[model samples]
Target: MAERTRQNNGNGKHVWRGIVIAILAVIVLAAFISSRKGEVPVRVDHVTKQDLITTISTNGKVEPMENFEAHAPAPTTVRKIYVREGQRVRQGELLMQLDDADARAQAARALAQTKAAEADQHAIQSGGTQEEVLNTRSELVKAQAERDSAQKNYDAVQKLAQTGAAAPAEVREAASRLTAAQAQLKVLQDKQQDRYSRPEVNRVEAQVEQARASYTAAQDLLKHSEIRAPFEGTVYSIPIKQGEYVQQGELLIQLANLRRVQVRAFVDEPELGKLAVNQPVTVSWDALPGKIWRGEISQMPYTITTYGTRNVGQVLCAVDNEDSRLLPNINVTVNVSIANKKDVVTIAREALHEDENGRYVYVIRNGHLERQTVEAGIANNTRIEIMNGVQPGEVIALNSMNAGTPLRPGLEVRAR
Candidate 1:
């Protein structure tokens, strides 16, 4: 009875092991069949002939084509503000006014100084002042009269001496008086003739010029204290309150014509070569969504400069803002259209692949994916121009439906 029981247990162990092995073999075969027969659903596109435009995008700023800025001409207080921010003003309209009392006082003082300097210059040129000239004339007349009197007395003394009525010593004293009077008269005449030297005249003239220049500058400051619009524009900025004190050269107001504007685009140095004058450009501001402003390149950069972390060139684009929506100094995005090709064979950019052998695309022909080497031309953000190897109406794989599934030639695929 014990031997029979042992024999039965051994048979049962063998049977159970065989059954487990059979079940595992069936699962492995089923997995292999499923993988082999699975079809990779992919996104596909049809190659077609259409217009394609190539563009490059970069950051920019909106600025007025005609702009004006005013600063404090002298240290003063803001007297009044005629226009508020965002006010539309005509040319020559008053915008703001500074406390011009000090400027006027300075101008008046300068004018007085100029007048005084001019009087001094005139006096120097004319040899002497009116009073001094009159005094000298009076002295000349007195000296002449004394000389004549002394001469007459000397003549009388000579006659008396000849007539033996006067002594020789008296006649000699009369001659000495005449000589002294004549010397005094000669000194007065010389003094009138050369009252000032050449250097003295030059010095006075220079002072007159300096005073005149100072007066002119003072007048200019006074005029600038009353700010006026240089052209028809919109006032965009006023940095001070009506009663605020400001220093010379401090920013006061800013204005610009909102009818026309320019966008200054900062393009990276590598993309500078693709830029040219008259190229179409589009600008969009983040502050105003869904609004686009169109323009053209007005000026090209002559030199490259560092902008943030990029070496960039500044390109100017002229835009029309007739509605006056775009404001100055606003940040915006710019797209420059470099090239436009019409009616050309094109494909989605994702369908074009590049490798060591150059550019290629997988085309769907007769219900199977076929890899074809391609020659490409210009490309834009979403599409690429295929010069050859890919024809119109051919379907190409954009991407695999299952992520990470490799796109291979001869793989069976169906559009998702």
Candidate 2:
């Protein structure tokens, strides 16, 4: 009986060991299958022959062709404004008016003074007329007749003194009076000559011209009170209201021409050499997405700008706008195509990689990843041109991979 019991215990132990071994084997198989399922799958794309375009992209703003600020020319109170903000205006259209009552009064006074001066100048230029000359001559003749009578008396007195028929004191008094009369006659003759040729008249003529110029200046100021638009444009802003006092050079309104818009963008110095006049460009505004406006490079600034660790040069592009949607200072994006190539080997931009040895890519050969050194050319945001070391229809890995990542040239790979 003891021997039988020992045999049964041994048999039970052996059966238990066998069952445990089978369960371990099943667990190992299940783990191997789960590990295979957890492995990360890589994605890839194929190189192909297609047209490749290289473009430079940057953000910009749309600005009007011309922007101007209108200011008050002189200090005055606003009388009336004909237009409001955002109003369309034509060249020479009246915009605003200032109280010009004082200006008008001043101008009138200046004109009156100018007219009086002119009349005085005309009279001076044309010296005394024939009648006035004759009148002066008559006065001179009368003075001469009186002087002749005095001279005769003096001559008679001298003869008496010589004959000793009168006192010497009386003869001396007569001689003094004769001398005064002759001096008076000479003064009259000189006065008559001055009437014909008056030199002072020319000085009066200069004063008249000065007064006329002042009058013209006052008239111009009065006209300037009625402000007019300088060019055809839309009114952007109106800062002044009627009865508001504005100083000289104060902001009154703003204007801009919206028909033609320009995009001002900056380009790096390295890319500056690739830009030229009339180069084709494509522009899109943030306000109007999916709408590309075609344009050309209109101007390139000669000087470079330095701003907070950035060095760039300015480039201006002229865009045509038929709908007049583009306004001043609207942000935009620009794409300038620098070059294009056709029938070129190209791949997605994600396929290219860089390291210490320079640019490289991974190509699949015989179902395995193979390292490839490539020379790249013009690249756009989507694809890059493969200049050399690659061919068309070749499979390339899209994502980056490690060098010692257990990849073989001919090993089978399941591209995700």
Candidate 3:
């Protein structure tokens, strides 16, 4: 009986072991089948030909194309202001005036002095005044009379001597008297000549010139007391009131030509490399609501700088402001179209990936994932331009949620 029991136990053990091995074989086979049969659920997209416009957005500042700032010319009181803020004015229009009583008085004094100096110069250049000329003429007449009388006496004495009526010694004395009278007449005429030395005239003329220069300077200072518009524009600021005392170089007024405006864009340093000259730009301001301003990049910064809390590079653009709606120093949104493409194959940026071989994407076809290497061009925040390696209308796998978990070659996928 013991031998029979032992044989039965061995049989039972072999039977149980065989059953367990068979069950384990079945489990392994089921696991393999499930692994091969399962599909990865993924987000997918169809590559399409579309226009892609790549842009970089940033904040910008609005400024006038031409700005003018006026300052006080002297430490004086403001007498009058002709134009108010927001008033349009023509070039050279009188804008304001300071108390010019002192300047005007100084100008009058300078004018009087200039005239006096000019008169003195003229008298010296002309040798003498009218009265002195008349006196010289009288002296010339008297000397001429004396010379004529003495000559007549000498002639008469010579005639008498020839006729034997006057002694020879008396004739000689008469001739000597005539000679002395002629010499005296010549000396008187020389003293009374109209010509004066050049040095004396030039000295007086220098005084006249100095006085004239002073008069000109005084006139200029008086004119400067009244401010004038430097160009045709609108006055936007006035810091001084009438009858207010102001110092020299104080702020007086601010003006600008609002026909056109400029925008200064502060771009992040990372995006600065994408900026270029003449790129199309769009600007909008919160204050103006629905209005859009159009422009193009006119200037770009050569180096990076700091703006507020960010390191940025500056870019300048010009906007048309014919209606003068956009004001100076206003904040606005700036969009720069850095790159663009016409009709081209594109995919969402999320569908693209990069590896050592460069950029790539997974194409889903026939329930399998196909790895594709591609050349990419311009890309914006949401879309990427596929330059090559992927055809239009190909399905691209974006995401997967399964055991395999990611896009892989020959992996089974089902797009949702």
Candidate 4:
């Protein structure tokens, strides 16, 4: 019994010892792993500066250089429509015509009146012929003779009434006749005075002028019935149809001059300051891939719009479209080279880092990676200009290294 108890105690002691040894082994193994982790080298990359040309990209739209809206000059019904949308037209080409029946009638009436007035005016200016003048004189003589005979009869009747040989009624009737004859003689005298003074010609000339003015107004209204293109262009839209009633100044069609296309692009305000007139620009359209259309800055909007995703100034560029296939409102991409430098030091943009202090970069020296502050300028999406604190052919770390690891200014590293 004593031997068995002693054996069990011995076995318990051995098990405890084994447990302690296993625990010690685990601790030592963990310590070894920690030491190995500390010695693991971090992976990094290098960067070097090179010359880069800075560029700005923006979305723009293609537009026509000139657009015109045709409108009805007066209220009328359309009689004829001569052109369709997209039809090429020349200046002075008849686009449409309005019903001009009333206008024509008015013009005809006015023209006849004008002709009559003109004839009267000519007669007045050329005065009466010698034969006509003589005839007028003869009529005046006859009127004078009639007046004298009536006066003689009136005087004789008055004398007879004083002698009671003529009735009072008869004497009154004779006096009325003499008064009528004297009135007639006065009218003849006035007519003679006008003819000699040419006053009648002046009155006729005034009548003729009034008729001529009416005629001219009627002709002008008639001309308005025929609508003509004001300039050479393509018809973009036609809103009215034949027999459609249109009010004055109503839009009829849209005409656009497509000889040259204009692109309207919004440039960043910061970039606008660098742009100038005649700056060369490259334009691309998704509709026509691999084709680059050349253009130049033609105009810049004086006003700035604050409503877009980015507040920018509007600029207009004129592109030569000899083929005339380029139309308005096409989506376009514009790449403008704002600045270019030759043989200048530049670095990949990813290699640069910044904090509150300013711009900086990670540089490797003697196998050690260190953060070096840098001055940057004219950076683009892919690259940045290293103005200072960085040299050409110097390797720079692209990402942050583990601080707890043994990374220092002179530590060796393998790029991954």
State the C-alpha lDDT per candidate: 0.92, 0.80, 0.87, 0.79
Q: Which ten residues in a row have the lowest lDDT in candidate 1?
A: 32-41
- Point to the candidate with the largest lDDT: 1
Candidate 3 on 310-377: residue-level lDDT in tens?
99988999988777777788889998998888998899999999988788999987999999999999
Error of 3 at 366 (Å): 5.9
Please give the distance, in angstroms, between residue 177's alpha carbon in candidate 2 and its true position after superposition: 12
Q: After superposition, how far is residue 29 of candidate 4 from its true place, in Å?
A: 15
Q: Which residue ranges in model 2 land beyond 4 Å of their true spot?
A: 1-40, 48-51, 59-63, 127-210, 342-344, 354-358, 388-393, 400-413
lDDT of 2 by residue, 57-139 (tens): 87667777887786776778999989987788999999888889878888999999898887766554443555666776787
Clashes of each: 0, 0, 0, 6
Clashing pairs in 4: 47-396, 49-346, 50-346, 367-411, 368-409, 368-411
In model 2, the clashing pairs are none
How do all models score by TM-score?
0.82, 0.69, 0.68, 0.59
Clashing pairs in 3: none
- Span of ten consecutive residues with least summed lDDT in model 2: 400-409
How many residue pairs in model 2 have overlapping backbones? 0
RMSD of each: 9.4, 8.5, 9.7, 11.3
Candidate 3 least-lDDT 10 residues? 189-198
lDDT of 2: 0.80
State how far residue 16 of model 3 sits from its true place (Å): 32
Candidate 1 lDDT over 1-416, as tens digits, reads 99999999999999999999999999999998786567788899999999999999999999888999999998999999999999899999999999999999999999999999999988876668999989989999999999999999999999999989999999999999999999999999887888888898889999999999999999999999999999999999888899999999999999999988999999999998889999999988888899998999999999999999999999999998887889998999999999999999999999999999899999887667899999999999989999999889989998888786789899788776
Tens-digit lDDT string for candidate 4 (1-416): 99999999999999999999999999999998775653425555444545677767888888877888767766878989999988899999998888888788988999999898887766444445556667767888988998999999999999999999999998999999899889988877776555545576777778788888988888887887887888898887787888999898998877888878898888878778888778777888788888888878889779778745788888898887766666777778887767777777788787878889898876776655677899888866788888899887788776535566544445555455
